[model samples]
Target: MRPVPLVLPLAGLPHRVPGDTDAVVVGGGVAGISAAVVLAERGVRVTMVEAADTLGGRLGAWPHTLPDGTRQIVEHGFHAFFRQYYTWRAILRRADPALGFLRPVVGYPVISRRWPDEDLTGLPAAPPLSLLALFVRSPSLGLRDITGADRSLALELLGYHRERSTPALDAMPAGKFLDRFGITERARSMLFEAFARSFFCDPDALSAAELVAMFHFYFLGNPEGLGFDAPDTDYLSCIWTPLADHLTRHGGRIRAGAAADTVEPADDHRWRVRVAGGAQVTARHLVLALDPAGLRGLAERSPGLRRVGPALAERAAGLRVAPPFAVSRLWLDRDVAPGRATFSAVTGEPTLDSVTCYHRLEEPSRRWAATTGGSVLELHSYACVEPDAAQATARMRDELAALWPETRDAVVRHQLCRYEATAPSFPPGAAGARPTVQTDARGVRVAGDFVELPWCAGLMERSAMSGILAANEVLAEEGAAAEPVHGVPQRGLLAGWTPMTRRRR
Candidate 1:
């Protein structure tokens, strides 16, 4: 089946020559790379500039030497590859046609300190049945809990009515929606709240519409089940380096460590982007595949961007960033029990939200574990309230000990902690205000997870999808066929039984 068409309306862009140096794509994240790759494949000369020395942006990793003289590549955190991420998979397939670098995670495991040994597995793969199995088998939930839920909200969640339900869900907070539907406090905390917080947004602050959309995307609408996959190695070797090679092979230029300081319109009608250290390049089209903060910084510093007028400035100014999040990785001198899960969702912990046994899941770490008989664990905290890295790390360690007592005695051989502000917040009523791929400024497009995508995907998938849409926007202006973007169907059974079915009968 063909992918869904994006609803990007670029009415007034002027056609331009698709020649060498035709486009300058800023920010070398997934979005930037995706855009650059598409442009280069279409025989458009594209120059990609990245502030960091690497091309992965948030997905970038840096090498760190352990005290024992071993080196490892430290990353921001773990990333899950859901099956519905068609565009991202397609992009990866361009480099590695076989997609041999990914490893599947067999089951979804949600754990709590209150019951560390509990087996929260065996939920059926298919939905309605899966939902039923979960409710039936869960130790925390009961029949009364399901019966007490508000019928209308439950129906809206299970019954697919995109036109009528999307706006209604968008108007309320996810926490409020759960409370209104009478979802039990324990059930909410264990499942819904944990899932919401995993995305770095508190349930009370995030949009109910976004939560519902994710439910459909990851659980209900999914064809490959709720299980996810992850890269078998560091993102640098597996994803970024390969993509960079692919882009260059397709005739695209990449400039690492070249930070674009400002982007302004030149006298010749082309956009002049000035990099740090006095380097400058002019291109016919510019794609700002930057994060919200980066975009704001560009607009604030560049007189050219400001001169584009109030509409673009207002949209950029209105963008909201979520609170800071933190990731901590520990190298222990002892191994976790072999039977313990490789990855798990954590609740009832003060600072730790999830944990991954990298030694079990990643090939490099697995080989290291075999040699040293040790373990490598990564802990994550979303929307962290800690004031400093030390405090966050301390809390995470203590919580980790609480959940897995073995960690308390495991000697730390090496450790790394990172705290930074990341991802855009999806607050109640924030959907309509989010920017799209096309901006009011001519020849300028934006791509990021925060941008309003036509499809219901978020995080890394959203970033890649937005990149595809951004490139297509420029292609449409050049009178080229827009690239197809894929999205999973949201309406399951309802999709098969349309009004036309009744009319035909």
Candidate 2:
């Protein structure tokens, strides 16, 4: 399960691009910044224009003052930096070579009101063994559950091959696929259902192929196992600022608050991007790295893009945004009982999905807690059904209290609630509709988590991979060496093997 280097640095190539080579990356999240870093280091004059006032996109954080005049940096939500994310880790190395900001989070446990917490961390690192350990140790899934379930269907989870699995399960809903497995309700809810919501959609609306792919990517095929880490400080100080400094040191410029309004084909083999304030940037290479809806809007505005990259234009039109997600960070007057995991994935809840005791995870939160004798807790709902932020926050707080009784009486010192529909939705039959890093347009490329990728990756890793791939395409066009990209074992251990089919005898 160790990493396999898919793209290696080539020999006999110059380290930097020739003069006059420039790239305009249109989004400044992980994807856009990733591309910018690679391109800038290669002597490509890179200009990254981000729509928001701050970088990081969905992972972005900014300054906020609590009611007591205590300053804090808040984020869109919590993210787990899995060790298997080699590509993302490589990119992060540019900022902090040792990646010192990240600290290991102990014990990833899935909590529920119906059953005791099911720990998913520290299993064997490789599949078959890893899968076996989970089967042997997890109380939620046991012998009776397996015997009563469809054995052949359950085996498919271990034998995930992109060629076979994507074709076989892409058209089915994840909920339907899970139901067909015939596992016990406890196993389904605690293990599978809880994991599915992390993708920002209900299992019923997500593609079964995605569920299987994720199973392989995060658990079965992953060599690094399930353990993950988080930053010891806020993203602004640790991630964004350092990254921004790194990019600038290589002659790159990041223009925050410069939202792109329209993209038009320009003269002399260049693309012209019109910003909100009537300013425009024209560059020879254009990386359209934006959210699903942002890409669609820009594509719709650029009528001439159809002539250059009809497929990209069409795919942008078809791209679907996932349901709205809500994150509520509260400054509680008191802490929860001892031994609560830093992060807990909750299942079988109406609106709540996960909770993070920020005070236990980050340094800034810990300092705030020490100064005020209060804790900082964050609740997240990937696919929130609530109508607004306030309602969602209230519901999540109530759900958390139900799970941890001590939280019921804790006073909310200050709370920040955020709601947005920005994550991509992988609905059934959405396999290839997304655009890839290299588009039909001569010098235009796309990079985002939503962008289609040949190898298996998810979340932040996917964004980093697409961005690196996009930069590689630009490097290829410029006759420069491509940056190396590593990948996990593409197929599961039992990829070529199939269990007995329940079809005809």
Candidate 3:
């Protein structure tokens, strides 16, 4: 089905007509695209340069197929879309109208050996009110168990919202918070191994403040109608189409495989970029939308950027990209009994993390089955160990054999692909320490998910927003009237409060 079209509200500012001005945009990820799109719309001639052959850096690598070439069983990496992602959904709707956004029939199930086998069945049909409601209401835990630390269960979950005001929560590990709540040993094990592996991959290692911030981002303010699930469409085709189409229609240029090797600040506050192919391009404005690590190559070109170099280097240093979390999607060789929109077999078995049937959606059962062919069963399990491609293959085969009794013989063709860095790790106040968009140099500016505000939760929407901000900074320097992009407006980042302004409606 085609996705619906949408009209994104451009942050309106005074329109200043430039005299044949050109801006160079670095990186081709969501952040870069977002900034490029906004600038193009503002009549800025943007030449977006990407080092990779593709636009999406890490994001493009995701939603890929396995050896046997199966389809994605879950939502896109980067970030799972919900109703709250107005900007993201607007782009998808504009791209194609038939893209159906369907919430999973079950709430995200937290599986553990201590829970009952059937406990993960279709999560209770409670309207998502808050993170606490979503968690406290799940069949996995009892109120008494969660509220044992405090007299009031409501206070226990939501009341501590203010504890983050102090530095202790930022310094505390998630284990400390869980212990204070008196969470069961089984629950803790399950959260760290099974549930977290599905996203964070190392919940125990993640900071309590970052976790609390995530809780706040999802459930704090926008408490109504917050259900979590996968989108019912192709990942890139849904969001990228509209943004790309808009840029193309506006005479904006996007050239891939043109990795920018160096960017030198030229006279008159303009910049010159030397790409890998010996191609040289000069622009009055420049946007550095590449990641902090990726831009390390440019340190020699822009000397003024040296001050922010350490901050950028520090972010790159701490990055432990989640080694693709183990998830195997099995396509049954033959048809089997089909029912419901999504059927998950969460038997609470440590090895058998979860099973999903692709034929459950309203799409033609025969056609959908044809997509997977030979019947389909998608299996998801936590990474038992660090994944080495060949070793993971062998280990997946062994795990499949142990979990699916019928799969030992009946299975014909199956594919395995790990969800690489499904979610990025942001320690407490890490978002606050994000590098400045504007460097000490007059011309160069930064944009990307790794920047302060949006990518904290590591979602596509955040990166998109960051891109818009990055572009705005460069455009503004050229005396062009662009809206200021909003970064997370809070104190305690590095030291003083630095505002991250991105285009907003």
Top TM-score model: 2
lDDT of 3 by residue, 135-252 (tens): 6655445555555543232232333232333243566566566676565555545443344444443455656655544443344423224355554443455455555677778778
Evaluate all candidate structures by whole-model CA lDDT and list the values in order. 0.78, 0.91, 0.52
Candidate 1, poorest ten consecutive residues by summed lDDT: 495-504
**Which pairs of residues have clashing backbones in candidate 2?**
none
Q: Tens-digit lDDT track for model 2 on 1-505?
A: 5799989879987777755699999999999999999999998999999999999998898998988998888887789999989998999998899999999999989999989999999999987899889989999889878777876667778888888778778999999998888989999998999999999999999999999999989989999989999999998888999999999999998899999998888999999989999999999999988999999999998887777899989999999999999999999999888899999999999899999999998878999999989899999999999999999999999999999999999999899999999999999999988888888998999999999898889889999999999999999889889999998899888776756322321
Question: What RMSD does each model have against the real structure?
Answer: 4.3, 1.6, 7.5
Model with the higher lDDT, candidate 1 or 3:
1
- State residue 28's C-alpha deviation in candidate 1, in Å: 1.1
Ranking by lDDT: 2, 1, 3
Would you estimate the TM-scores of all the predictions? 0.91, 0.98, 0.73
Candidate 1 vs 2: which has more TM-score = 2
Native RMSD of candidate 1 (Å): 4.3
Backbone clash count, each prediction separately: 0, 0, 26
